[model samples]
Target: MENRAVLAAVLMAALLILYQVFFIPATAPPPPARAPEGVSKPVPPQEKTAPPPPAVLPAAKVLPRLPERTVSVDTPLYHAIVGSEGGRLLGWTLHYRGEKVLAERGQMGLSGLILERSGVGGQPVEFSITGGPVVLDGKAGEGTLVMTGEDAYGVRVRETATFRADQYAVDLSVRLENGRRVRQTLTVALPWIAPVKPGTDGAQWPSELVWQVDGTVHREPFDKATVAEETPGDWAGLDSLYYLTALIPKRPPTSPGLSLAVGKVGEDRVEVGLRGAVTLAAGEVWEARAQLYAGPKEYRQLRAHGLEGAINFGGFPLPRKYGGLPMEWLGVPVLLVMNFFYRFIGNYGVAIILLTVVTKVLFYPLTVKSMTSMKKMQTIQPQANALRAKHKSDPQRAQRETLELYRREGVNPLGGCLPMVIQVPIFYALYIALSVSVELQNAGFICFGRAPGWFPFVGGTDLWICDLAAPDPLYVLPILMGVTMFVQQKMQPTMGDPNQAKMMLIMPFVFTFMFLKLPSGLVLYWTVSNALQILQQRLMNRKPARVAGRGAKDVARV
Candidate 1:
């Protein structure tokens, strides 16, 4: 019996590993080869020994410098800033989450729309105010903000940003006019940036440069290569696990389309940007249009813009395969239900508990039958042992006779395992859901200060858990869960060799150690579940007559 349970667990683990290895696309490419430290490239030989009169430097490209002022725009969803210096998005804040989505704590606040001419030391095309501040009411469809300026090459650049009140998308239009009577090729870029702080909450989410090229999602980590693999589509930007700042073109760009650039900001953070370049002819006003979406990676919100692919649902988002046994099949439904529960309870901890209860209820009948079968096996153990000893010389005969005895008593050898085996998918699906759902970020179940006044040791202090998404700081939940699991295991009618029983006993501790670092929310779910099973088993044990068979059959020898 112990071997059967162990085999079931092993099979489930193998399937999950295979699914991840074979199905989940590689979001992070191989790290590029590193340059040898302390070994500089060999200097090329010069034709003449005399350093030819200081190699001429390329001409500096500049734009008219306007007095730096932050233009503030407020919407129901987010607050944004446009710097007059470069007409760049300086700051962006999501109101509900109180998180800054734009660049902070670094130079080069070229956070949104900026243009660069093709020359050495080329400055970004900074715009001057072409009109008064544009305002959009929440009831309105669109609010337009326009700024116009000229580059050092005398090329007129007009930038227009149409902000919407109902959604996170901003319609961006950039027009380059070659008013200088000379054609110019300028690199147009929509920069999306967030400071990288390794090994923090910020590091928990993957931050990478992602773009679609011919329908394939190509992602490059910010700390990876500097030069990007020039993807063709104008859809490119940076994203973290929970939020996405992307530039999606209304139409694909001409030749020399989407290119990526990665840079380091001081010693602490890295910057990633996607640039789209287009050539403008003399007396032409070439407009490059794209929609900028910078906000939380809510599935429904992003799905509306055909950017649903950005929401990594912790598994393949394709239609159900393996006859709907895929993790996504269960995970998505569980997540949606949990979200619905949160709407009423307003607490994720409560929602998770409700979900656990719902799962337990759904499997209640199967679990009861499994427990009854285990109890029957426990009752027949002595006779089974006697038969094993009597027929020790005939192994096949002993197995056949044992199966006959079990059938005569109406017992199922595999009954204890089959029910649990069926639940592996649902368990894993819930686990994955809890791991990656952004709604659980910073959600709290129990905090010391929030505890009741009479609660011992944990009341009026920060000693207990503060965030359900993080591990239990005091390790209390994991230890309790381990203890409950062990108790449940002990209460079960486990019929096995002594060594096997000892191994089964140790499984609880092994699981406890494995779950120590998992999110407290998940641990809480497991703990509650284990406690419920123990209670259910105890109740079932008191009703032994319910599963009792005829006395003669129950006493039959194998």
Candidate 2:
């Protein structure tokens, strides 16, 4: 019981630390006066400026007359809109696990390509399409949208966006023909911006710019007055909780002109994107070919495209340079197994339950060893108390006798503690996976959408618990989790100081309060895990071995 309490305390303290690091609400800075939509030039991180100014469009010296009509492209994986005047992407909606992440943000244009010149004045080329609203039926012959236009300033531009009915990626190519007599350098910006959704406080909003620089991923929150960074990378974009919009250059720019910018577009609105530069000489036709991905941030899908770096599984509060260490190493395997189970079970909640069962089965041997060691220690509690009483006059003698007693009984004092410690990484891995996996967002185990008769008041999933990604509205899971934890603690063999045992009893309540507002899926994982531990403990401790002829004898073999 002492070892059990120690293990519980250590686990709880670690969990609280992790929770504070990952989930504590980020304090939003005082709202700045709304800034205009544009790219803010990159600034040195150490410098401070008074009333940091808004960003400017790298591609446009003056804002062009954007078209009123928006062209829509519908595909199986995503839906996108493009404006006619600038041929800019106006909106992108991601569909995954039967949930729409960006559809409700009305007219939220996500990712689009652009062109800019440093000395050239006047709005960048305003593209006019000859034909539009391409509808692709991902078949033997896929559909495509081609928009072509030319500027009077000796530059002609053509943008062709091809879509397939079944894939999330949009094959895009921007061809620029420089008809000038001298060489010209143009800044190409692919802005991937989405309107911040309503009803979400600044703390809950995960709006951010994420990118990979030299094989390392960097994530920056867009809540500040201005944020701009230049890096050397071929891929960059922005993301929310479930959706991602990224641009990958088929050919990297000549110079490391990759920069990220985020600025306010209107009241309660933010726009973000990446900018790069390309130089064109007289009569030189330059074509920038790239792939655009706008869809859910599913691990498998992102991994297939080498964008797995996008999925962040939170780990120890170490600096990101440490790579989140053991958690990242373990999280991927756990997530893969969960995804595999989900394929067969067809529900994330059920998958999590199966995951817990499998983990228990895998660790059965260690658990049995730990429990057996603790039970042996409990069996010798009377002798241990007598020794302490006998040695009341000699503190050193009592400690020596205790060590001798353990050795004579052939019980390893560290056995009970080591096994529990070994199990920490596995549980931590599952915690990180459940919290970050896109597959769990809006997933339901016993959803009312599938079975309305089961849930009346909260018609989402499992009676009162509807969305697994969100908290349990009625707090039933958290309470049950606390109860199971208490039961598991009670099942451990009692051989600890009274004060420490009392502390163990209060831990469950502390955990219950702490988990009140966490994701239901996470709480469900804990509750199921605790119940399994209880069942395992009961089975292991059912028939205690009896002492006979100076040796322990088992009545039945486990």
Candidate 3:
């Protein structure tokens, strides 16, 4: 008996040590490296030298041929045609397909492609296209497409359809004839260029994407790989999560100039502006064409526009970070299905509820078997307790006898936990899906309040109670959840000491607090699931009781 007690103690100790060592805290893989801080131009590799300088076009050779028919030009920027069949442009070339800005220069500080300026009120002079004097069916029709700056701060150029057939491929161009010799410095802000590394002082990694001039190369620094706060304000509110600058080469003789600036307007938007400067002779025209992309991180649209690697779906902290990929992968299918269902249902909240129901139905068999096993064990608890009392001084013997009792009753001690273990991954997957799905970011639910903010709060207060996303501050949902769990436990046959029932009672509140901050969508699922489990248990309990004596001896075989 003494030897058996020692052996049991050693085995239990070993199991506990193994559990602590292997399962206590899960670790994730290392993340990718972040960009370095401060500006240091990247040196071209000796093996791959920079290409020879571009050929400059002279004024006479580059001038467009004038058409016989005269048309009135009324826009602030003069629109002119270059070739008989080429497109027309105001002072600049009309880049209908959009031109990538290699680099820009102006009265601003440049970091990569971000240009920063203070006190400048006028719009940054950039490229713009002149709408068509398009000819349709060989008949001249008049319509103007004007691309201009919203304010003195920036320019927005959009494609416009012209009725002129000859204008299909117009050669658009811009000419900047400045009166003063502007002292402008150019900076490259292309993603293809090496990223600005994070500073050693642990300053926030500059939240910007890199752009390339020569080729379609872009790189978005992974949020997990860097320590940077997503600046909040109008820009963030606008949901313009990421930004990039294009780098284009200079047109001619005047030095290629690039400018990038970063500025903040109070607590509103963090504006990033890029400008290209050309020093013009009194009558000389310094022209450059550039393309700008300003929108949400729509990966497909961005890639279609030849802007690759510019979409940054911010990654969360560590072990959680590793989970992003799997979560996104799972989300794709779930979102698709949910979207389809929502189209038919017209209610996101109802869709979620229906989705939960479908999931429960699919998992019902496993749950049913688990619950049935628990019931059987509950029925046999009296016998298990008798065995425990019989060998009170010898735990090993008691445990072995309990096992024998379980076997005779055809009960598996781990049966109930097995199904629960399987459900954990799915639950976590749902958690991740709800957190990052942009569709759900600002989605609304039934009166529970706006879906939830990035994090939960009560009426914008920090106090934990009003956080509906988290636990019910009133303890209503959690209390109900706990009650259901307690009933589930009661309905199940007991396997260990009756004292453990108190521990089971504590689990619902523990889980409730843990889930309070979670999205209401998740909470709804759990609440429904708990209710269903209770209903299922009640139904299961209604079945006739098993004849005990006949199965008692048979339990040892299992």
Candidate 4:
């Protein structure tokens, strides 16, 4: 029964395959068409469209240059004037520093520097700025003047001068905007143009260029404004001996191409800038911002702005490990003491005298030792002269013999000098401190008010000896200093060669000449020191001072 069912299933499968092959077609039959020839075809016309007109930028603008004008800036500390030309920092009258602006017009009364960019493609170098009559009115008011200018290519520049109330500093920023169609490389410069008087004029603040680069400070006279080569500096500006004008970068420039270029422009002008290729694409901005300090170099105030190094207390030659002659370190305390005394005495000049007295008193013992040693040398001078004559043909032998004679006579050749040598640093420090002390600016020991037109070196409203920071107009202090030095030299034992006495005499005249233009404060100190030494010499001569050896008693007191 199973074999029969399988046979029937096979037959049914065969029949199903036969039916499918017979009924269905392998491919679809062609459809019946109504029109199958070119007679029924139709062609459409072609059309070409032109592109939208190419974009054309407007020609670079040529704006009318406006007349330059001065904008007034008033703060608690100073009154400043900023000009529309290059947005230059024209001048500022210092109110707190107690100094009147005596400079003639266009003669950098103070800080005519820090704004100008390198121009290209016949672009005018100076920006024709247009802004406002800036008013920084009250004590707390942020005195800000933002002046803007643009060139023919639409390259705009902005200069901003901001003042903080009751401070001796002004914040300045220069920003460049590239509105050109092509990329632009901008070079910004802030230069000072002033007719600087040659040589040391005591009344004039000496002109110089100062810059800080790579943790080092550099200085150059006005004649040598720029460095030997371009360098990347943190700040650069022209500085007077006491007043400082700096353009300090607000931050380290990320671009390596930017460097500071400083150099004299023409015969009278010197300038500095954050100079380099500050490349800007079209519509991009490049900014060179800095803090401007235009005031007396007060230690504390300058330190506040990280400009204490600008004070320029003369550097002493020494290895890096041992700061040679701690001038600033010692000078600072010296200043502090002077100021401390000033607080009580209300007179810096009197404070200087007191400081001299204190120094003399402190070193009285050393002075006595020096005097006694000199006295001993004088007692043995005749024998020393005989020995020198005997050994005249042999110079080295003469020196040895002189030394042996000194040893036998209990005389120290360096004794008189060593004591004074020990005090040299103090004197030098005092000089440095006084030379740069702004507190002494317009400070007077004796005031005769304004001098007559006949006053030498200074005329017409010339303050006569009214400012200790300046040279004595009448030259009285210098002459007095010379006389005191002469008297002091005379009191010292004349034990050396006869030529030595002549040299000593010549020194007083030389010093007088040198001090003739030196600041009166330093001259006053030296004069007072000489006077004190002479007084000490007279007193010690009567006391029969002993030497440092066994026969000290036998050494006759001068």
- Candidate 4: the clashing residue pairs are 114-190, 115-190, 191-271, 226-262
What is the per-residue lDDT of model 4 for residues 339-394, given as tens digits with 9 covering 90 to 100? 88999999888999999899899889998888888887776766667767777899
Q: What does candidate 3's lDDT look like per residue over 30-63, in tens digits? A: 3223212112122233343455333232221122
Q: Rate the local accuracy (lDDT) of all candidates.
A: 0.68, 0.68, 0.43, 0.68
Give the residue spans of candidate 2 off by over 4 A.
Answer: 1-68, 97-112, 120-124, 137-141, 194-206, 224-226, 252-272, 317-326, 449-462, 546-558
lDDT, candidate 2, residue 115? 63
For model 4, give the 10-residue run with minimal summed lDDT. 35-44
Show model 3 residue runs off by greater than 4 Å. Answer: 1-125, 128-325, 392-397, 445-492, 513-517, 544-558
lDDT tens readout by residue for model 1, 391-468 = 899999888878877887678989889999888778878887787676766677776445555768656545566677
> Which residue runs of candidate 4 sit more than 4 Å off their true CA positions?
1-59, 96-141, 148-151, 154-159, 174-184, 195-206, 224-230, 253-258, 266-268, 281-287, 315-336, 379-411, 436-438, 450-464, 494-514, 547-558
Which candidate's TM-score is highest?
A: 2
C-alpha positional error of residue 144 in candidate 4 after TM-score superposition, expressed in Å = 2.0
Writing each residue's lDDT as its tens digit, candidate 2 over 104-185 gives 3334554345566555533445666655566765553356677776665566788877777766777777777666655556
The per-residue C-alpha lDDT of model 4 at residue 123 equals 33
